[model samples]
Target: MHPYLQIMIGFARSGVLGYGGGPSVIPLIEYEAVKNYKWMNSDEFGETLALANTLPGPIATKMAAYIGYKVKGPLGAIVAVTAHILPSLIALIGILTFFYSFRSSPFISGMVQGVTPVIAVMLFMMALDFLKKGSKGLGVRWAMILAVFAFLLLQILTLHPGIVIAIFLTSAFIFATYRGRKTMKQNFEQESREKVQ
Candidate 1:
């Protein structure tokens, strides 16, 4: 199959079935891109997800664009984004009108109630996967420390999320710089000792 068509199909599936909005759609997209399609490895997908969160836009759109571009190019991005968005757009205008009218029905209400728990579980599973991935890169000890700090700041202290994020990013940056310099200094000293011999 053509990459363009694959992009359309993959994203179209995600956009159409992605109930409960962005968080739900993300795991579906991850399954498509990382597992089924093999377009990106788990580590790359993790980075892409992180970058998408930092950007100012819908997560689904950001992910669609990234995956499409990776598969092909600029044109692939356009096709993927359009495919992803068009389903929801059409559904919103077409199907949702009927759904809205029947929303008060017991059947519709029961359906929603049933689906909500599934969505919650999906979100929880994704959160655990992402947490494990993050912990691997940051190391278990640092990851625990950072997680505790973030929870305290955001949940207990009621600090703004942006401020908490900035604090953590700065801490990570400083730690990285110090670690790099220490490694370099050790390498230099080792080289000098070898030269003296």
Candidate 2:
């Protein structure tokens, strides 16, 4: 198959199989792009995800565009994005048609019920991957701890994630600045000692 076609198929599979939207799609994309195709490494995938999250568009689309650009430039980006959406587009229509055709059927409802667990599992796996990757060292590990605590508080205690994320960012910035200054001062002292010698 053509490269573009293959890329398209990969994305379509991702869309069709991915459960919980953009975040959920990451693992699928990583599987295809990193594990299967050897297009990038885990670190590159992390960077791509960060860039995607930082930008304004949908995460899945952002990834599709990036991967597509890597493989085939502008046209590839377009093709990948279109393919990523195509499955959902078709699926939505099919679902609607089924609902209309079987409005009274318990079978359709039961299928929906059955799929919910699968979606939950997929989302859980994705979350685990993020946690494993994001918590790199002691500092980041602590950061992850704080982040997760904040998230749990938000979810269970009716706090907001925005506030938690803001706090994390503020704390990180301050800590980084302090650490940077401390390192610089230490370096300066070492240089002065050498000069005296």
Candidate 3:
């Protein structure tokens, strides 16, 4: 099939089936982008996700646009974002009255309850995968500590997520710069010693 059609189908599936809003839709998008299409690897997807979180607007649309642009450029981005949102738009318009009528029904409530745990588990698994990758760079102990610190900042202090992300990004930049300079200096010093000997 053509790439555009594939993009349409992939994003449409994510948009339509993604219950519980943006956060829940992320794993579905990841599956399509990383596993199914092979557009990017997990690491790339994780990095894109982090960057996307730092930006405003809906996460799913941002991801769709990025993946589309990567695949087929500007037109592809337009197609991808449209596909992602169209289903939800049509469904909302078609079912708004029906949903409102049954919103308080036991059947509807039970369905929501059943789906909630599944969404939670999906999110947990995704986080675990990211944590494993993060541990490789940060070390397991530091990874756990940072995870707990993030949790406290988010849950206890009620800090905004964007602020927390900014703090971490700034720290990572500083640490990486320092480490690079240190490595360069050590290499230079070692070469000088060898020349003198």
Candidate 4:
């Protein structure tokens, strides 16, 4: 099939099936991008997700645009974002009046309550997958430390997520630069010692 059609189907499935909101839609998007379309692997998806989070606006659309552009070009980005949001937009428009009428009904309340856990589980699983991959790169100890620190910032201190992400990103950059310089210095020292010997 054509790439555009594939993009439409993948994003449409994510947009339509994804309940709750942007966060909830993320796992579905990951499935489409990583698992279904083979557009990227899990690690690449995670990196893209991190980059998207640092940006403003809705994440799902941002991811859609990025993936689409990667696959095709500017036009692909447009198609991908439209495909991802249009389904949800049309559904909301069609159901808004009906949903508003029954917003307070017990049946509606129960339905939401039932689905809440499912969304939570999906998010939790995704988090775990990210953590597992992070541990592989940073070691389990460092990954756990960062995770705890992030949790404290987000849940306890109630810092905005964007702020927390910025802090971590800056720290990682500094750490990487320092480590690189240190390694180079060590290699230089080793070479000098070998020459003296």
Q: Which candidate is the best by lDDT?
A: 4
lDDT of 1 at 117: 92
Candidate 3 wrongly placed segments (more than 4 Å): none
lDDT per residue as tens, model 4, 78-118: 99999999988999898887889999899989988999999
List the candidate numbers ranked by lDDT, top first. Answer: 4, 3, 1, 2
lDDT (tens digit, per residue) of candidate 1 on 1-197: 87788899999999999987787899899988999888999889977876676667788999999989999999989998999999889998997789999988999889889999998999899878877987888888877877888899989999866567667678778999999999999999999999999
| Worst lDDT 10-window in candidate 1 | 160-169
Query: Tens digit of lDDT per residue, candidate 3, span 97-116?
Result: 78788988999889889999
Model 1: lDDT of residue 18: 93
Residue-level error in angstroms, candidate 1, position 45: 0.6
Give all candidate RMSDs, comma-separated.
Answer: 2.1, 3.2, 1.0, 1.3
Give the per-residue Cα lDDT of candidate 1 at 22.
Answer: 81
User: Number of clashing pairs, model 1?
Assistant: 0
Give a tens-digit lDDT track for model 2, residues 42-148: 88887687656656768888999999899889998999999999889889899788788997789877877897887778778866666777677446767587667
lDDT of 4: 0.94
- lDDT scores in order: 0.87, 0.80, 0.93, 0.94
The superposed Cα distance between candidate 3 and the true structure at residue 195, in angstroms, equals 1.2
Worst 10 residues of 2 by lDDT: 159-168
**Arrange candidates by TM-score, highest first: which order?**
3, 4, 1, 2
Q: Cα deviation of 174 in candidate 1 (Å)?
A: 3.0
TM-score of 2: 0.77
Please report the TM-score between candidate 4 and the true structure.
Answer: 0.95
